[model samples]
Target: MSLSAHGAEGAITNALTIDVEDYFQVSAFAPYIARSEWDQRECRVEHNVQRILELLRQHQTQATFFTLGWIAERYPALVRAIVADGHELASHGYGHERASDLSEQAFADDIGRAKKLLEDLSGKAVLGYRAPSFSIGTGNLWAFDCLAAAGYRYSSSIYPIKHDHYGMPDAPRFAHQVREGLIEVPVTTLRMLDRNLPASGGGYFRLLPYGVSRWMFKRVNAADRQAAVFYFHPWEIDTGQPRIEGLDRKSRFRHYVNIDRNYAKLQRLLGDFSWGRMDQIFLPDQQAGAAVV
Candidate 1:
């Protein structure tokens, strides 16, 4: 599909992305669940992902899956299934380590390991990387350099908003070249009354009214003339997954609110707009150059 087509008057194909990690591995739950105990916890990621796949299939849309190396290692078949279904497979780093918390070298190693593992399993070059929890920020600008050096062509790691955990409020709000050849696609946000509002997906999609989210994307497409990058995790649809206890009220709210309603909201979002794989929408030319293992 041509980029201009999406940019044209009535056909705007936004980027739909899935952050493929289990509920237990989420950053909000990191404080409560130790990484060492990950294997012991019930894993609902495979089924949750399959559900997402079915949803996408019903809509006949493709998306980018920023899969965790941990998940890919354990569910190689699921990773293969994603590729087999004609979706883009990208890296979400191994072990879900935050970029800000790791040294430059450690961050590089984490992405490198995950990228290679994903490429091997999916038999496709993993050209994109997203920091776990959108953790790459002003302090860790070196993360982009690491990504470029490690053969990544683009990154969707920054959220241009003010948040306690992660955001680079001043970063470009659309896809743009960051390093010499690397592109940084910040999460979609709307500028209203001189403030940036989160319109991209995630818990924000769950917490906010569906109409508001729909309006934001429509405004972005109609006024800004740019495709929005919408994202969510697999576990968002698995409302039946076991819940963790003792999380502060804020964490609980952010992670669990509107779980039962998200799947339908996603269906509405899917039907309202055109969608495509990230590479197809943003890095079209490089697709042929994607690494082959």
Candidate 2:
């Protein structure tokens, strides 16, 4: 779809996304734990995702799962289960490598492999892709071209806020056509004091009071009059997962803070607003009548 193809419709329905990676696979933990040890670490993602599925079921909500191709290969049944439950199955690339870290060809191969693997597993056209950690930005705008070449219709790969790890502070906050056929729907942010504040999910959602997060999303809906894009990982809600030892205080705090309360907080979020898959909300042509939620 082109830029002119997208239109703002009434009845804003926010895009709810899940980055389906294990706790050990988080970008922050990459320094402490090597990718070779990923297979050795106790795999808790299956259980965690099942819990997430149940939670969404209770709330009668549907979401986009930007799942890792690595996980899908090991747990094909889980991929089938997500499709069986009627959720959109998207790609999180083959491995969780940041697009900024890869050569264009390597990035192309990664996304291509993941897209094919996911489509084969789910027997559905995988139309969306999200970078490992929102790693696509001005430096690697070519990643958008790669995504379009790989046949992905949309990408939620950029975060508009400034961050030490990954963000393009000057990027568009709302969905925009970054390539001929691909849309870059960045995660939500709130404009405050002349800067983009992180209003969507991730560590911020866990660190702040649930009320604050709710207020931010409401502000985006009522004030900005735009549907918000929120995201989180499965491991975030698992308080009992084994703690990684000998980590920097910053990484430790960012990963584990408020894990005990996040699940309940997420439950409240589901009830507070309307949510739907990325394709339904952004690629309206693929999901006609979805604009009204």
Give the Cα lDDT of each candidate: 0.90, 0.90
For model 2, how does the per-residue alpha-carbon lDDT over 188-245 read when each residue is reduced to its tens digit? 9999999999989999999999999999998988887788999999999998899999
Clashes of each: 0, 0
lDDT of 2 at 199: 88
Which run of 10 residues does model 2 get worst, by summed lDDT? 1-10
The local lDDT score (0 to 100) that residue 24 gets in candidate 1 is: 95
Q: By TM-score, how accurate is candidate 1? A: 0.96
TM-score per candidate, chains pooled? 0.96, 0.95
Tell me the alpha-carbon RMSD of every candidate: 2.1, 3.6
Per-residue lDDT over 1-293 for candidate 1, one digit per residue giving the tens place of the 0 to 100 score: 11312745578889999999999999889889999999999999999999999999999999999999999999999999999899999999999989999999999999999999998887799888999989988898999999999999889999999998888888878888889879988879999988799999998999999999999999998888888999999999888999898999999999989999999999999999999888887886775435584
